[model samples]
Target: MTTVLIVASNVPAQPAVLTEALERFKGRGARVAVACFFDAAELEIDPALAEIRSFAVPKEQIDKRLRTALGRAPANRKIWLHAQRSGWLMKWARTADLLVAIDPRSVHTVWEMAQRNVAASACYGLVPALRALDAGVSAPVTTRLERQVSATAARGVRGARRAAISSAKTTLRKATGQKVMGTPAGAWLWTRAVSAPKIPDRYRSKLAARVHDSAVRAGRHAEAARAATAAVSRITNAATRAELLTKAAQSELAVGRVPERLHDAISAQLTLADSLLRKDRKRAATALSNAWSLASNRVLHFDRLSSPLVDDPAGYLAPFRASEAARLLSAPRGRSVPAAPVPSGRPLRILLATLINDNFLHEIRQRYEAMPNVEVRFLDLDDDPARRSLARSGSSVIEHKLAGHTPYGEKIEEWLRPHLDWADTVFIDWCQATAALFTMPDPGDTRIVIRLHSFEAFNFWPHLVDFSRVDDVVFVSDHLRDLSTAVLPQLLGAEAPRLWVIDNAMDLQRYARPKPAQARFNLGMVGVGSVAKDPRWTIEVLRHLRRQDERYQLLLIGSDLNAKTSVAAKQYADLLKRDLAELEPSGAVQRRGQTDDVPAALAEVGVIVSSSVRESFHCGLVEGAASGAVPVVRDWPYFAGGAHGARTLFPADWVVDSPAQAAERILAATATEEDWRRSGQAAAEHTLKTWDWTVTQTAFDRLFLTD
Candidate 1:
């Protein structure tokens, strides 16, 4: 068998690339041996490749002399020294017909081996080695004395060139080292050099980053910021300027510090996006998307107790409003024809569409499917990989808008035009990617309706939607409608789609189960998986109640907060862990986790609390009320003191402004067994009469059946 040996100084950056090369080599009847300087466990090799063998250099097995030599050698030369002492690798190298270096650090080791194993074909990189194999190995030809002398001269010249380049790199490193950057004069000198005229944009950006990093490491953050800003100001290339500033901002955010030039960085990206819109739409989309990501980072918004978007919506969004590219995204594309009237003779064809999230559609779907005069069809873009990709390609949507027409736009038309032709109306569940995609192509005479839930109002998806193509916009509550209109503003224009506030459809009757007497002091909360839910606020309320009466305990439902979402989320989760650790072992806080049998779970809860920072209409709290639990709703800070909010959505007595107020309400409502039961019964009756599916379906009927 033809033996092939591959050497890597470190773990392969792209294992799939190495795997494909190995498989190709095996197909050619080659027995491969891979030698890695690092541990073998870091790379997961397929056991099925039994013909291939791998060896990891065991540091413990090396003698003191070799280990000391390895520690002192440069990174690349150390690989060569390690291989020279590895008996198993040396044995394979002697017999191998082909030698390959998978990475740059291994190239030097392979080159040294090639001088000893002159008969074997050697190459740097997998592709060059593969090409060498394809050319077939041959015996070395004899050379004259003159040719040998000439080859020696060429090697000496190349070695000298490499030495010169290494010396230059050493000098550059010293010039911008942390010790030098610690001084004000050194920092100022390097900053000026980076911003000097005629420096290549690529080189200037890289140098500016190095200087900034060195200054920051030397405890000169202000100097680092000034250096980056100065360098960016000199960069005439829009893409390069935006990229450098964005990197600076991201580096700050990664270290848990907000960037001083955060707004400037966003503005640079938006300017780049606008400049590239017509010439290169894809690039423009990328720049715009990056701008949005930086602006809406969790550190700036959700992870904190307050958000700039909430505290100062107009001021925070001023950058987006000023961007021409953002304007193009929201630019109205009016429909060619108004929606056709509901079918007179045949059934009205209704299409319900969403991407993966079908939690809110079960009731509406069942209601329409059971009706004889309606033909219902459901489209989940996620069901098909190709369709899902098209639906979620926000960049492609932006590109199509800028270029006026693109293959992506045509693909959207091809995929959705047939559904539009078949359906008299399409109801898109969330104002997200699905909504934006549906509006990409004109719906012809098919009416388009989209629902804006609480979260979508804070996301970029709503901004991508073209409201002129939609006939109606639905909100679950009046507070949500008010917030949505304030955020979009276009919704209030004369040409904007008709807005409606329809309560969410829910079957609340199933929750009317008998509660045991002990349940009167147990509090319940559902859906604590997001930062907005603010489970910590609920914990605070629990603390207040327990101070007065030790009988009160909290039953936390739903999944735990996902800390992996963002740094702010992780900080919040850490604080929550500390709270749980204090109360959980004492049996004061009980975690029931997630359960499908929510109504049964409600049987143990006497009071339901909504301690959210914001909510459109809290479905879980209402469901608890239907189960004969007194409701205590926080004013939902996102809309408090507005035209409509939690106070207007629920009864005035049920809403509270603070944890102490919530505790007082809970105590008064549950003063005695008779009073508690009577209060829960009253709340249950109010919720059942107002928000149940039986009561809300009529409004849906009027929406779909009449119009």
Candidate 2:
């Protein structure tokens, strides 16, 4: 049998290539053996080739002297050292008729083995080894001598060149070290070098990043920002300039601080997006997506008490307004025909569509399904994997809109066009990815209605939606409508869809259960899982209440905040843990995490609080109110002073401006059991009459049933 040996210093880049080469060798009647430097389990070779022997080097068995040398050596030289000490590998190499190195790291080891075993034919790759075998000859004597002479000459030149490069790298590392970068003179010298005229863009960007990172580590953040700014200013290419600034911004965000050049980075990316909009839409979409990610980072918005989006909506979004690429995304793509009135001839076909969130749709879906005059089909893209992937691809949607058509656009048509043809109207929840995707293909005469909740107004998805394809846009509260319109001016344009403020449909009657007199001392909050919920605000109110009456306790109902969501989230979560540590053990605060039966959980709550920084309608608070819990709402900061906000949405006395005000209201409402019961009863009656499904369903009917 002809023995063939293969050496791999690392896992094969393409395992299938090695597997196929092995099969071909076995078919030609050669016995195969593999020497793996890495763990054998990492190689996913076919188990059918069980007869092939695999020899793996044990890392622990190597001597200390050899291990120390291996650390400083190149990967190719390290493999040679490992092979020299492995007895099994040496035996296999000596016996093999054909030797092959599967990757560059193993080449040096194979070359040394070939010299020791001159009878064997040596090759650097599978194809070369196969060619050697096909030729039916080991290398000619003259060719082997010439190869040895050439290798000796090349080694001398390589050794000298490597020495020079190593010396230069060592000097450069010292010059940019933390001790040097901490000094102003060092920072100035590097900044000037990076921004020097005629420096290649690729090299300048890379050097700037290295210098900035070193300076930041040395506590010279201002100098790092200057270096990046100077480097970016000198970059002639818009894309490169955007990319370097974006990297600098991301590095700061990764460390949980807002970038100093955040707006500059966003503006640079928008400029690049605009320049590439017509010629290279895929690239433009990537640039725009990067800009959006930087602008809407959680550290700047959700984790903090105030957000730029709420503080200055127009100023925060000015870059997007100036970009032609963003304009194209928002540009009206009018439907061919206005939706026909709900057909009188047959039952009205209503399709309810969303990506994954169906929490808000249960009431509306059940209402329509029971109607004798309506036919209902609910489509959640998540139900089908193929459709789900297409729905979630926001970049592809942006590209398709800019290009006017793509294979992705065709797939969307294939997936949703049939449903559009069948339905009289489609009500899509959350003006997010699903809304943008459904609007990709013209809805023909099928009415498109999208509901904009609170979160979408702060993100990029609302811009991606084709509003002209929609017949009506629904908002759960007037405050949400105001914010959405301010963020997206397309809503007020000539081709904009009809905007309506419809209260979310909720079943309030189920929560109107009797509460025990002891419940008068219990304060409750339903949803505290997100940063926006501001559970810490409720904790502060609990602190105030407890100082006056030690009997007062707080109940938090929902999942704990997820720290893994972002660095900002982790910071907030860590602080929340400190608060819980002091209150949780003393019976002052309790957690009744995520329960399906909200009504049962609310039976112990005497006062319900909405401490969120923002909300579309604060559904949980309203639900608690429906259960006879007196509502204490913090004027949602995102829309506190707006024309139509929590103040206008709820009764005048229900909204409070601060934690102290909320504590005062809660104390007044729960002073006496009789007084608390009376207050809760009035709140319950108002919510049931104003916000219940029975009352809101008529507005939906007018939207769908009427033209």
Candidate 3:
């Protein structure tokens, strides 16, 4: 019989692995013990494996001062102090035949003990430790000495680099710290030296570095950092101080670049991230984002990557898999207990939820509000003034989702936890915010249903959801489901929720209006802002039509591409503008900025064109077809080989693989206005019969009703 002990940090998914290891060992007459400094939440052990005892000293008992002091101490000293004080660890360690350090932070303490106890085997992970305990191969003593020597050499190298950096930083700090510029006389002297016209870029950077070094020597980090930052800025050569500092910080963050002295890189990045965030600049936000990537730990050198927490909530956060934070984020569903034999039904309760999009909810709410058994409520997280202010400013954004878990995640959970407790079923709309908030797992026994549309699949939100609590995942199309499952591995976990495919709810009855005869030769496109839309191809098809007959005109709808979002977007907008410039004045094309009257917009489009590379459903094109426009869809390259997308959404003849093919279809349809009207009439009937809200509402009903 063997006993194994596992010591770990409060990482995401610890309990599941712990339980599995115990189960594997139980067959071999092995007993396991577990320990943690932080709460475990994301996973739980089976009752059979619950015999494993894990120890923890209350976080409140630890002193912040001591923690800080320990952080600055020598490596061996830190381990010695920690082991001596953490008696729970020592007590548990004494009984174990095999000891495992579940995280890097816990590895040192285990190593320290292994030096004193030669009979026990030590491993880095649960799997390795369990294997060692089962096989019964104990660690050798002289081999331990060799391991210690190698570890000491590695630590020495890191210490030397950190020492060199500390020395240089001190020198720079003193040079820049002086209040020299604060005095008029000193400012004048500094101004003359910096403003020297003939000083080449190389010389200027050298002088700036010297000045910065002087500021550091004077004991002023603020002044030194400032002088260094300023000198780097003033040197005209791109390779000067300013460029060098940024490069130095970035290069130092490269994998294994400066693990020991990496604090400065993180500090520089945060300084820049905060500055950009304060000023509300998007470009600076991107630069800071790159800085964060380089600063991340590749494997185990630094802190474990947050990507795992965001990507695979259950598996990655296993250590914290069953804590209040983890449970609140990932609620485990209990087996059905047959609803306590209802003698008499009082009323039905319905919870209405839309994360950021409240589009179809108005009608859904209206229907439920009139029912005696149903209660309707609406919550918009973005409506909060603080969040709104952040979105409007778009500054210092915390690199999308890494920033997601902080202010946004906490505020959302606080607001939604109560609602989740009471509602029998919560319908979370739009997989972005809705899925993310509900996935935090405080279900309070309420059933969770998340609806996935097109864009959410491409983003980081779905990855943030804790699937343990989600009762049902609703996808708009099979193609979206396929893509989402392919990109996210956690969705396939044992606890993953059942999935349902339902079309988007659109009131197509409004688009059952009449169309003008001239629309027969017109090609209309709605929402051309994204590069994924590939509107340029639509223009090619239009040009081909015009060569055969000038009667064909294209109508473009929606606001132009936004320059604020990205440089690539701005560049694409420029090229689009040039294309529009030639076509608009020639009466070959028309631009309608934005309008609330969609039925009216569809009226002028006899031939609706969907030119996107991918789409979950393409609601606009369907609406246009219902308005009597013949639909022509690009094969939708993103899902061309997948199970379903634009091709399956529309009729077989309606989908075209290329611009040339689209032009061919247009030419045949508009051979005569009479012929075009007949073809469009058939398309309108098929669209209304197949994809209208009347039909889609049934699909949604079945999904919500099925357990």
Q: Which number leads on TM-score?
A: 2
Q: Candidate 1's C-alpha lDDT? A: 0.86
Candidate 2 structure quality by residue, lDDT tens digits, 246-309: 9888877766677888899999999999988878888998998888888878877777667888
For every model shown, what is its TM-score relative to the native structure? 0.79, 0.86, 0.53
Q: In terms of TM-score, which candidate is stronger, 1 or 2?
A: 2
After superposing candidate 2 on the true structure, give the runs of residues whose Cα lies further than 4 Å from its correct spot: 6-30, 34-96, 100-131, 134-136, 140-142, 149-198, 213-221
Candidate 2 deviation (Cα RMSD)? 4.9
lDDT of 3 at 286: 52
- Candidate 1 colliding pairs: none
What's model 1's TM-score? 0.79
- Write the residue-wise lDDT of candidate 3 on 287-312 in tens digits: 44444344333321112111232244
Question: For candidate 1, lDDT tens digit of each residue in 209-312?
Answer: 87877776687789889889889988888888888888878766655456778888899999999888778778898999898878877766666566667766
Candidate 3 global lDDT: 0.63
